[model samples]
Target: MASSPLKTICIYGAGALGGAIAAKLATGLGEQVTVSVVARGAHLEAIRAQGLRLWEAGADRPLVARMTATDNAAELPPQDLVITGLKGHQLTAAAPGIAGLLHSGTRVAMILNGVPWWYFHRDRQSGHAERQIEELDPNGELWRRIGPERVIGCVAYQGAEVINPGEVELSNNGRFILGEPSGENSVDIEAIATLLREAGVNISISPRIRDEIWSKLMGNAAFNPISALTRALMSDIMQNPALAAMVGDVMNEVKAVAESLGARIAISVEERLERSRQIGPVRTSTLQDLLAGKPLEITPLVGAVVSLAKLTGISTPTSATILALVTQLDRENMRAAE
Candidate 1:
């Protein structure tokens, strides 16, 4: 496949994942492709004042990537590619601004957790697909605005966190798996994959992105909410045999739902749980969001699985219970913040 030249790339929501991506792209692809970031508050200020400072997963020194930084999306030029690092819950709100970065040839790559709004867009079957997950996309704003034609499905396996303003610490350096919403290979998709690879990001272009989504979601659906409710890291939860069993149950339910939807998750539940234990004292993204007083990515992470269970007519009692508990925790967290 011939690789097309990438003129410009913009990363929306330059937090952990976005910042880590920006750092690599700006530093590794310097002058090869134009890199810019859309961030806000002190992080934006620091990026503007200084370059993005990134401590790569296992490095002694941090790397500084100087690139364009702005809070105003309107200020950015039309991009060849726009990678949205915002959580599923945050996408609709940021949809309009994200739209401004698009041109006719631009591709929007979403690298977030759990089920995406585009899950059923082209990957739909007769009675199983959802036209709208109201919990994830209220009022169909993202669907109407961004549309599914321009989407590039990306599953980011990497774990990173913004330790402070203008700085990101990568805890895991995993491959980014990408595919088209319609599950077709294209020159544009190949181009984006090549660009990321050139920029030192481990990348894979999947034939069935949904399978990849579920592969990651199975773990996220179990780990994230459990960590939030228990206020524990992956290590802490796995240390307790009872908690580990519960996590296993949640994962099994999710696997059932995924297989019902015709998505194959090759990894066994035991393997996923074991991997979680090996990750050590890592805080799940949901826990981090709760601790920061930010909105929870609950709907897509856990609620989506429960919704799928209903669609598949499968009973997910354990998943439902955990979803209920976590949803309330999120509601209370939001209420208290207000």
Candidate 2:
């Protein structure tokens, strides 16, 4: 099949990060590309009424990017690029909807945290050989419906939040690390990078994207759960002696497991923790989800680590305990909401 001209883009889950991307692309592209969002509820309503709004730090006013917004993906035509910003647990349920927005040349970018569902799909060097991550995709719904071949691995380093129904505030303008699973500098990957760069977004293409994924996960697996469990900020977690040490332990375990599975950790545990500490007093996405009464990405962030540890004979005592507690918290909180 011929490569797509790459004009159309659909952001599957237009919450914080997705909203930022959509707003930037739609506004910066200036009719060059057609950008749309799949959003629902009050957020969807707000976007439909007033367009997607974004407020980056230091900006005097928010950026209102006029674009199409829909709750149903089936309503839209086949897209050239589908960027999925959904949480790990949410991806499975949204898989079929995402499929409704694709064509043969469509590429799906998974801009998510922790270990992605398609982590083992085409990376044969891991010796996992297309094995499904049980925690992230237990039913194989995502793998079967979305297909790993369409995935463009992405590691997003930005922090943003939905302050209101349709308004998102960016904490930092971070770049996205994108790659292809086949380890080839394919046309699809470069095209996506070119589009993102043209929109004033920083992007880096890597052959060893799995290494970048592991490097990003090292901080998230520790910080996200801890933030939710303690209601602490990034600065708080880094400054507190007890919490800092605990995250360090979890980082070490994650590093071991990743190295065992053929992923190279980019930095030391101390360096990772220090870098996190340097960030401002910001609430993590997990903590934000907990406060919003939304489902936490526990299974993907922490539970997945424990599962991998058992597989690789890596002892993750700290990670195991944190996973258990957060799992219970998620269950009890959801049960009470009902």
Candidate 3:
């Protein structure tokens, strides 16, 4: 679909990251390219009423952009490119609504954290070809509905949040990496990357998307759950000698699992840890979710790691313990919120 025109785009689950991206696209892309966001509750109403406002990282003022904001994706027309900013736990419920915005050649670019639902699709070397990742998708909902064939892998590197209804705040000048599961520099990937670039998004198109997923998973699997459990930021966790050492163990284990599955993580565990530590005092997604009383996105970040470790016959004691603890934390936190 190289010749495919990206005239219409939708941001599914326009929370923090999605809202930030949508705000940029709406203001950056002119009348020629229409950007719409699918949000819910008070956020949607605020966007409808006062437009989506974004405060760039380190900015004093917010940039407001007016575009289509709706609760139901069916209310909008079929989109050409749908970039999802939904968290791990929200996709199943939003799958149908997301599907409603798809046509024949629509590409669903998932800018989610941790392992994606389509991680096993077309990834034969993982020795789990087309196998269901029940940790990420307990049912076959995402796989059956939004077939892996239509997915465009995206790894987000920045932080964004919905500070208030209809307002998004950026933690940094975040960038995104996009690729296809088949590792092809296909037309769809190029088109989407170019469109995002045109909208002032720092984008990179990579062929080894699975490798990228594993690399990012290192931090998500380790720092996120640990941070939530301890209520500390990445820097804080890495500063303590014992916690930092535990994080290193988790990253190494995750690396072993990825290599066993045929994905190469180029960097060493120490380097990854140092890089994460340098990111300073930013709160991890898991930590933020915990403090906000939202559902903890556990499976994709850590549970999936344990599931894969078992598949690869690799021992991940630290990761396993963290997973068990975080899983229960999610349940108890959710219940308490209720």
Give per-model TM-scores: 0.96, 0.97, 0.96
For residues 65-158, what per-residue lDDT tens digits would candidate 3 score against the true structure? 9998888888999999998989878999988988888899899999877878998888856778788887677688888788899999999898
- Give the Å error, residue 32, model 1: 1.4
Off by over 4 Å in 3: 1-4
List per-candidate RMSD values in Å.
1.6, 2.0, 1.8
Question: CA shift at 165, candidate 1, in angstroms?
Answer: 0.9
* Candidate 2 Cα errors over 4 Å, as ranges: 1-4
- Model 1 Cα lDDT, one tens digit per residue, 36-77: 999999999999898999998789999999899998999998
Please list the C-alpha lDDT of all candidates, in the order they appear: 0.88, 0.89, 0.88
Candidate 1: where are CA atoms >4 Å away? 1-3, 124-130
Tens-digit lDDT string for candidate 2 (274-297): 787789999999999999999889
TM-score, model 2 to reference: 0.97
Best by lDDT: 2
